[model samples]
Target: MTLRLAGGIDVGSCTTKSVIVDDGGNILGSHVLYSGTDFEGASDIAWRETLSLAGVSSTDSICVFSTGYGRNSVSFATNSLTEISCHARGCLHYFSGPMTIVDIGGQDNKIIKLDQKGLRVSFKMNRKCAAGTGAFLEEMALRLRLPLEKLNDLAKQADGEVTLGSYCTVFSGTEVLEKIKSGAALDHIVRGLFHSVVKRILEMDTFTDTVVMTGGVIEHNPFLIDLLKTHIQNDIVTPPHPQIMGALGAALYALQEAPHNMD
Candidate 1:
């Protein structure tokens, strides 16, 4: 059997994602891995792992595109694209209507707005601090002596909401400790942390019609979407493969933009 494949690698600050797609844009295989400090290694592992999952080798690849913070480090990629362009492109694949994209990633967050015609109208990002990103949750989890993955479940235990006032990661950590000392329920505090993340992102920019959530954070803590829906009146949407959207978009780029004759 012969295979026509396009691949994408996204090396984010916290985690890396890769996706393989057929000519029809169907996802054949995908992989997600911790990025750690070595972007090159993350890129390598993501590509190989996805290819492995697809039961193919590099020889089957038509082209590989790269995105995210470490897009330039993916040595085997035919080309590279930015996370903003890639996310917008990727999210549009799911809902091609007017939508605002909220991507919560490892070290930063981005709000990308696309019009009904699939053109970017405006965008905003938070990279100055770890206040609203995945790092914030990781730090809060550490201070609470809980695994980051447990935050969603913990937040579900709270009946009443707690609003965390501090957006600074350091101060928030201190605040969480103070809350614990004051005998606040761990679950309420956890929900408050989730609220703070959504609050910080909402404060970044004004959103439009349909709101879409993407990225690793959204994938792990789905409760964040429930919390977010409470803030916005518009219906919310999440792509099927939230964590690998950038990589999928990159693969789509490869399929569309890459030379058909290229190997």
Candidate 2:
């Protein structure tokens, strides 16, 4: 018998992610990389890398589903779905029952509420501003002359308290500079930034008893999860491979929607 596989590609604005899974819903391989300027190229690279990691040849027959901001750009996709559906599906894969999903992407953030049956009840998204998204952190990192990856660790080290008054990325960046001039601790400022991100998300919608956080931002900066727990009394959790939840959902959809025999 031939091995059956399904694949998912998420062509996000800032990064592309690919995932492969077996019929049993077990992830076989996954890859994440920057989307850069070419969404097509990025999706191709991510898919190839994911296939390679899964020990599958390029010639293997598989169904591929795509999602994310540039989902339509994935020329190889067998079908496509919205990021909201993908994220909610992905989160439900790990945590059952009703839950709220908070996905902090590079360009925007989403809040998805699912019912006990795992169906979406309502959702919210923030796209008009970058203040609470990954781009905001990246810009602040640049302004602070710090590497983006270092922000999580710096925020973890914060011993003092600081607050950012601006919800606009540009104004917040300026506020960061002013804070620096005032000799505020760098770690404190970073922590404040993380706080701002959590605050922004909280303001978007009310939470359920359980909240599952996903997306690259939360994957890299788990400190944000801890911060969220402090602010909300609900149970906060993260699914395995938090960054690739969308791709995983897409892959699951591929498996469910595709025929068993591709040969």
The predictions' CA RMSDs to the true structure, in order, are 1.7, 1.2
In model 1, the runs with Cα more than 4 Å from the true position are: 58-61, 261-263
lDDT of 1 by residue, 74-118 (tens): 988989999998898888778886999999999999999998898
Write one digit per residue (lDDT tens) for candidate 2, span 117-152: 999999999968877999999988889899888989
Q: Residue 4 error for model 1, in Å?
A: 2.7
Note the Cα lDDT for every prediction shown: 0.88, 0.91
Query: Best candidate, TM-score-wise?
Result: 2
In terms of lDDT, which candidate is strongest?
2
The window of 10 residues in a row where model 1 has the poorest summed lDDT is 254-263
TM-score of 1: 0.96
